[model samples]
Target: MKDFSAEITYKTSRSSGAGGQNVNKVETAVTAIWNVMESAVFRFDEKLRISEKLKNRINSEGLLQMTASESRTQVQNKKIVTEKMLDLVEKALFVPKKRLATKPSKGQIQKRIDNKKKLSEKKENRKFRF
Candidate 1:
């Protein structure tokens, strides 16, 4: 929505990767947490939709959490997690168009029957009658 950054809080930890000494010395991994139940960026209905759709990512306390550790810097990882959370929230709020059920045309049904009869008659003619 319109910048939910204000509602997001971050936690950082040491990242595990091939960063050598840097990985051991610095806390590069970042986790972005947002309280879906207490968010002011989204309306009540939108918040409910986000909670329902992102239930897997949300904790029992109704907080949505995302972690990013791909990069070797805290700033990059923080940005990554924030972007991820925003993208997820946006996806959860999306409503797909309803699908309508339809049946095949009469012409299509006729074609299937015609093909079946043609094969049956061809096999019948192959019989040996003396």
Candidate 2:
């Protein structure tokens, strides 16, 4: 739901993969770059969360870059890259629920011990004895 239009910039270049003859003639690849450090739309906490969650995507200058070249036309590629960037930011802002540690139930622990005993007895019975 965050508006990143003002903070995002796009760069286009000839797509190296797919598109056959059109790849050589037209620049279809779109790279959408968003500067997380300078973004006015996000609060300090949100920016910190995004930087920590998307550390691999963010470059040294704190720019999050996403590229798309699946479509033959530049406009389609631009739209795809833009959507990808937005999705990335949205995911980065998500907070995961804390996991609680719990001990195994008594019945479950007993079941495991019973299984181990059964396996040990079975193996002992298989041994060659005179």
Largest TM-score belongs to which candidate? 1
Cα RMSD to the true fold for all candidates: 1.7, 2.3
Q: Give a tens-digit lDDT track for model 1, residues 84-112.
A: 88888888899999999999999999999
The residue ranges of model 2 lying beyond 4 angstroms of the native Cα positions read 18-21, 127-130
Candidate 2's error at 124, in angstroms?
Answer: 3.8
lDDT of all predictions, in order shown? 0.90, 0.91
TM-score of each: 0.88, 0.80
TM-score for model 1? 0.88
Candidate 2 lDDT by residue in tens digits, 1-130: 8878767899999999876798899988899999998999999999999999999989999999989998989999898888888888999898899999999999999999999999999999999999
Which candidate number maximizes lDDT? 2
